[model samples]
Target: MTKIEDVKLIEIPKVKDSRGNLAIIEKDSLPYPIKRVYYLYDVPSDAFRGGHSHIAQHEFLIPLSGSFDVIIDDATNKKTVTLNKPDKGLHIVPGIWRELENFSSGSVCLVLASDVFLESDYIRDYQDFKLSKSR
Candidate 1:
């Protein structure tokens, strides 16, 4: 069983240059080996994404551009995180529900996953997720 405290804000190594800055994420940056990489862009400000929890997957979310808020629920408590920096990432473990909202226009969310797409691993219903945590 994962707790809300388990969610963490990860800092990516950033190197500043005269013109711009570069943030990097190597294999050592995460706890799990990333197997899938995806992103979300052009999200409506009032819309939500990721209203579910995974059974076995872990994810690292980075705001590559603009900003957004991630609502994390652990069946016991809920917390909101604001992602506005390119060098910061949110690390999320399994057995916790998450929803992304308040996306600024042109915001891009990059996700690094521990596994390939697996529909069976996702718990989409909020009620079912709470019950699973109690077991």
Candidate 2:
């Protein structure tokens, strides 16, 4: 069976000026066209979120406010990415396990998804996750 991997890190453009900072991720601006969008905010202290992997969904996450660390894993590899800039976000591919951790106070995480919510599309268990990839 082949191993899956997390999405590559793509840098979003930030126009800095005296008027403040501005960032945007339009459908055409992303590596893949976005189909859905969501954000995580008001998270409790030291709370860990996202203990599942998608079977066919592509996700891009950013810390719109403050900062947080994203832990991503696959059957063969794992990585931790820190997202602090609203202009820069992490893109996660399907078939990868992900956990969001180390959130700063009052942090807001914004996510862009490739598909709408489908419970069957998620592989939540590590053991089942590995098996699913082999098929």
Candidate 3:
């Protein structure tokens, strides 16, 4: 069982330059090896995404462009965080429900996943997630 308090923000080391800046993620930056990388973009301000919880997979979410809110719930408690920095990411463990919303214009969300896509690993129902937590 994982607690909502276990969720955290990971800071990616940024390299400063006169031209601009660069942030990189290496093995030392994450607890698991990333197997898949994806992104969300062009989302409407009124729309939301990710209303599911993973069974065994972990994910790291970063706001690559604008900003958005990530509402994470652990059946018993919930916490909302806003992401607007490219060098910071939210590290989410398994068995926590998450919702992405309040996206600013031209916002882009980058995700680094610990595993490849597996439908069986996802519990999409909020009620079902609650039941599982009760177990």
Compute the lDDT of residue 67 as modeled in candidate 3.
Answer: 100
Model 2: runs farther than 4 Å from truth? 1-6
lDDT of candidate 3 at residue 126, scale 0 to 100: 99
Write one digit per residue (lDDT tens) for candidate 2, span 80-109: 888887888888888888999999999999
TM-score of each: 0.99, 0.90, 0.98
Q: Put down candidate 1 lDDT per residue, 25-53, tens digits, no spaces.
A: 99798999999999999899999999999
Question: What global local distance difference test value does model 1 have?
Answer: 0.97
Model 2 residue 107 distance off true place after TM-score fit, in angstroms: 0.5
Query: What is the per-residue lDDT of model 3 for residues 19-74, given as tens digits with 9 covering 90 to 100?
Result: 98999999878999999999999999999999999999999999999999999999
Return the clash pairs for model 1, or none: none
Better of 2 and 3 by lDDT: 3
Candidate 3 is scored at a TM of: 0.98
Query: Model 1, poorest ten-residue lDDT window?
Result: 22-31
What ranges in model 1 sit over 4 Å off?
A: none
Candidate 3 lDDT:
0.96
